[model samples]
Target: MLISFGEHAKVVRLEILSKIGEGLQDRESGDRNTD
Candidate 1:
């Protein structure tokens, strides 16, 4: 059970990181367009 919990945590972390990365990319593109 503990091992599965750890695996679930890792997956959550990866999802959060990917979301942040996508947000950053969107902001960068928006900045370019404004310029």
Candidate 2:
């Protein structure tokens, strides 16, 4: 159970990081983030 929770948290963190990176990239490229 503890391992499953850790895995879930890792996945969520990865998703969040990807989103932030994408937002930054869009901003740098002067594209519409639209969020």
- Among these predictions, the greatest TM-score belongs to 1
Please give the CA lDDT of all the candidate structures.
0.95, 0.86
Q: For residues 1-35, what per-residue lDDT tens digits would candidate 2 score against the true structure? A: 35688899999999999999999997977755453
Weakest 10 consecutive residues of candidate 1 by summed lDDT: 1-10
Shift of residue 14 alpha carbon in model 1, Å: 0.4
Residue 10, model 1: lDDT of 97
What are the runs in model 1 whose C-alpha is more than 4 Å off?
A: 1-3
Q: Which residue pairs clash in candidate 1?
A: none
